[model samples]
Target: MPTFTALTTLVGKDSAEKLGEAMERLTPEPTGVGVFEIEDGSGLWEVGGYFTESPDAAGLAVLAAAFDAKPFVVSELPETDWVAKVKRELAPVKAGRFFVYGSHDADKVPVGSEPLLIEAAMAFGTGHHGTTLGCLKALDRIAGEGFHGRSVADIGCGTAVLAMGAARIWPETVLASDIDEVAVEVAEANVSANGLTGQVRCVEAAGFGHPDLAAKAPFDLVFANILKAPLVDLAPEMGANIQAGGFAILSGILNEQADEVVAAYDAAGFDVHTREEIGEWTTLTLCHR
Candidate 1:
């Protein structure tokens, strides 16, 4: 059996979402359809569909034309054990004192390293992508600068890698939240797996809305590894939640989009502390003024 993906990028969120909904109605219906904003400051949204069978090209063409999007680039995916493949391809990533790896590489954890276990699973933030790894590195850098977190939060904490990282290094209760309930569940699972059940509390919330997050406001550090639009949207709320002189580690931004995110935070009373680029992604460390 082969999997197929049909992907395209369009100008607006509404149209891209409409195209994603339309993709679900194809004759050989897609198993899943997703709409995501491109984080390159391009103001474009990408709509994609995954199919167990080959998609209807003409049907895709109709949807693209209706949405005024570029034609879908459909590709057949080969059958393979993706988990095993990921385990083979993704070696352990080390950021300062933190070592992130899966259980498959349990034996490889180096001596004297603060280990954070993030298995290759359905959720994001596995520490393999530049975004997650960069966040870990930023956190490591801040810690190296003699910063000790009294309070911390990880917004959009997929797999709670950042939360667990903070928990491992600092003596603080880290609140980890995600808009998706499933991601929160995965985060909790990861927390428990890493023996951080009491240190890292997982919740489902959009940004800083939930009571658990709000109650723990004026945090010393915050980690948000989501996309550019959300990062920009989160600035004011993030400023409200972080204490004066607090730190923020942000990623999931393309190299070209770093300036846009930085400007948004600057307007919200934060100043750039550090910037790191890993591959096409950029991670920013900012201090609340």
Candidate 2:
């Protein structure tokens, strides 16, 4: 079936969320509505809705005018198999010893390389993105230096790819957590797919808030591939959770934002061990002092 969408942009988060709630009450009501901040430093938030039937343009216009938002743009989206498209576009990624690929590329697993199967899904971190790729490489580098992670935690774990990567090399159970429940479910599925059901534990938590994670504190290594704001905010917590002389691999930072993140971690008693830049992203490996 063809899908239709109505999208509008507004100035503030509050207004955008209110507009999204209003869209839910429209005739032939939207199947789903979402409000997201546009991260271009524009202070703009995007409100959008998807529908199986054509959206009511008049209703959207009325809501836009009432909320002082831009005029809604309605469009009919062609029916397409998104999974097949993603499988076609996302080739396998190789970062040091780790190889990340979907089931379609199962035949391409190179011998002697640590294989990590991550099927395309609603969750993130397939290792194709620079942030994930860089983290994988940093993990490999740390292992190459003869560091064995007795306890590892992957904060904001998406598909649990990094957690699986750590599990592949070490015998200890790796903890993977994400704030989104759906992501935790997806991480569990990925862990099972990689035959890591017992090796990686998945949890739903923000940062280190979960009881299970708190019980497993002072990790020898931690992975937090989240944005700069949360990474900075979690600096003190990260320092507390990581053992002295342990490591933290952090990414999801723009190239220009690396220095600021480094400063935050530095103040939290971390010293930069290594830094890698991939495209527009930068990943840092920090040693807890």
Candidate 3:
């Protein structure tokens, strides 16, 4: 089956969302509509729709004009076996004490490093990305500084690689949560694949909203490898959920956005302990004050 996508960008979230709603009502209705901020400090929001068949170009044109957005660029996506393609393209990544590899690369695990199996499919957070890599490095640094987590949580834990990394070193049961249900399922599968079924608990939650996460509050450490806006929105709750003198390892931020994120967390009662830039992303370790 062929798949088609129509993409456009607008200035405001309200316009993007309204355009998404309008896309849903088009003939040959979109299978899915997604609206998201561009996140590059562009101040633009993107509205994209996926369709099983070719979309109505005229309808898209009208919506774009109505929303004051860029003209929709429609494209047909090739049907490719993404899993095999990813396996062929993504080499195993080494970040600090962690060696993250796909099952296909099992033979490459280094002797003394912590190994985490993350098959590249359906979810995010392979340690190859700078954000994930930086978080792993931060965790390693914290461990080297003689801190061990009593209880930890990874918010927006896509594949639970970070949680698994923490579990590999510490005695704590790491709770991994994500807003997407499919991501939770992926995390669970990765946990099992890593033989970490009892060590990492997976839940579907936005931030710390899940009761299981809330009950495990005042965590000794927390990892949130999600983007800027959510991290900022999560600051107050992060302050409340982390124990006094506990730590937070945060990533998924562009280097340019790190200062704003730091200010937000500082207002929420955290003091930046360390800052590391990997490629274009910045990872921060902060202590709750």
Quality of model 2 by C-alpha lDDT = 0.93
Please, what are the lDDT tens digits per residue for candidate 2 over residues 1-289?
Answer: 9899999899998999999999999999899999987755688999999999998878888999999999999999988888888898889999999999999999999999999999865425888899999999999999999999999999999888899999999999999999999889999999998999988999999999999999989899999998887899999999999999999999999998899999999999999999999999999999999
Q: What is the lDDT for 58 in model 1?
A: 96
Model 3 deviation from native, Cα RMSD in Å: 1.5
Q: Write the per-residue lDDT of candidate 1 for residues 30-63, one digit (tens) a residue.
A: 9999999775657899999999988999999988
Q: List the residue pairs that clash in candidate 2.
A: none
- Stretches of model 1 off by over 4 angstroms after superposition: 122-124
Model 1, position 178, has a per-residue lDDT of: 96
* Ordered list by TM-score, greatest first: 3, 1, 2
Model 3 over residues 265-285: C-alpha lDDT tens digits? 999999999999999999999
Question: What's the distance in Å from true for residue 157, model 2?
Answer: 0.8
Cα lDDT of candidate 3 equals 0.93
